[model samples]
Target: MSHTATPPPAMPPKLAEIVDEFASAPRDVVLEMLLEYSDAVPPLPETMTDRAGMEQVPECQTAFFLRVEVAADRTVTTWFDCPPEAPTTRAFAGILAEGLTGAGADQVLAVPDDLYQRMGLAQAISPLRVRGGTAILARLKRQVREQIG
Candidate 1:
């Protein structure tokens, strides 16, 4: 019998590109790209600086918090808080924040839950770390759903 591998679900364009990029990159390049993304995670907005309203992702080894807002037009904006010492977790936040922000809620909702797996991060980072990234995406998506409702 012959079987075909299932394709990943459709994702926001920017996120899809990031996943494709990491999927093809070498292990060293993946780690390098992750560090670059770590620097790309924008600082929380002035309103969110206190992080009082943010939800924590307990799966992360480091302290990580996030919030998602969906505009009337359904554009999604994400905020992530992660320590500079945890580059891997911050990179995951950067990827989601940069890629999902400005995207439509439907597009953001369409993103696969196992996005880190598609990004091939398990090859470059520890499985535990990868799980944190997965949890981040899950929480981000849940917040988006809550906002849109």
Candidate 2:
């Protein structure tokens, strides 16, 4: 009897895009890459008692993964690899904040939750799909830093 071989699962378009963007970046850049990618397409945050474990919520999705290993005083380094179906506006801030804390960052560099909510534009932060390149993601991060910080 002949058996047909099954094809491997396809990589999420968003993930492939993210890997291409920062595959060769430095640790900090990689952290930024992850945050940007996740903010664009965040995997759901996992729930847990411990903060670190709670951090796993987003990373567990087929969309993203976080790798943090650095040596710097009060330096935050968080990396997230997200699927293609995540939101990108207000959620991005929360995702980034959780990632920063999860990765041992002292604090997040984005806007505060209360302030963002006060603006009444939370729902607009829909998840972004990585279609063109990571440059867009990088640019968005810059904007977020400027507006929030």
Candidate 3:
């Protein structure tokens, strides 16, 4: 079946391009991209290396944690912690971190809630995993709102 992906919401140019890239790739290709992203997630900064600053996402079956920092100019920096065994969950973190990191708080907040659906991962990953991915984004946006407002 053919799927139509919605346009990305206002965001950084790089982030919007990443979303579009996933949306345009084949389902199997999307899965490959996810794996590639998982490897690309960067090490947490010294300030967040202590785990105390990171919030765990209980919605994911895996023990996933993340933190987002906003600069005076509203640019964002995100960090994620996840096990090697939980590549799928970690991929969500990597994708978010790679895609949205350095975006303005307003841009991150404007991202579409269903952006993950456009990745075409539903055919490869479980619904629960997909929900977890969405939850991660929701949490990111929540933290951004709380910090900047």
Candidate 4:
């Protein structure tokens, strides 16, 4: 069953690798990969460590806070505040931060809403968790638009 809203286009190189790697992995290994991504989520920068500076995602069961910035040159950077205990939430944050970092504001905006469907994670993770992935992207793009527009 196709979960993508449209034919998925080629993503940024780093993102494409992460998605493609998961798409081909067996169900048993998907969780392992997600845990790896959770580990890859860098610690929150000292400036953004405070909850007030970051926006919390109500859609997520865990406390997932994020900040998306578009620089004067239009380079996008994303940050996350998810705990180590919440691997699933942290994995989603990590994926977004890794995928969207260095991307242009327009590129980040062009990303589809139902991206997790294309990532082949639905079978391994809960529907709510997958939706949280899309929500993170949506919120990040919104923040980017607010910053650069």
- Which candidate gets the maximum TM-score versus the true structure? 1
Question: Clashes in model 4: which pairs?
Answer: none
Please provide TM-scores, in order, for all candidate models, with all chains considered together: 0.91, 0.28, 0.88, 0.87
Pairs that clash in candidate 3: none
lDDT string for model 3 (36-141, tens) is 8888678876766778788898999998888888889998888889988988998888888878867899889988888788767766789999999998889988
For all candidates in order, the CA lDDT equals 0.87, 0.35, 0.84, 0.81
Q: Return whichever of 1 and 3 wins on lDDT.
A: 1
Clashing residue pairs in candidate 1 (N, C-alpha, C atoms within 3 angstroms)? none
RMSD of each: 5.0, 18.1, 6.7, 6.1
lDDT score of residue 142 within candidate 2: 45
- What's the TM for model 1? 0.91
What is the clash count for each candidate, in the order shown? Answer: 0, 12, 0, 0
Question: After superposing candidate 2, which stretches have Cα over 4 Å from the reference?
Answer: 1-55, 58-70, 87-119, 123-149
Candidate 4 residue-wise lDDT, 25-64, digit = tens: 8889888988788877878777776865788888988888
Count backbone clashes in candidate 4.
0
State which candidate has the highest lDDT. Answer: 1
RMSD of 3: 6.7
Worst 10 residues of 1 by lDDT: 6-15
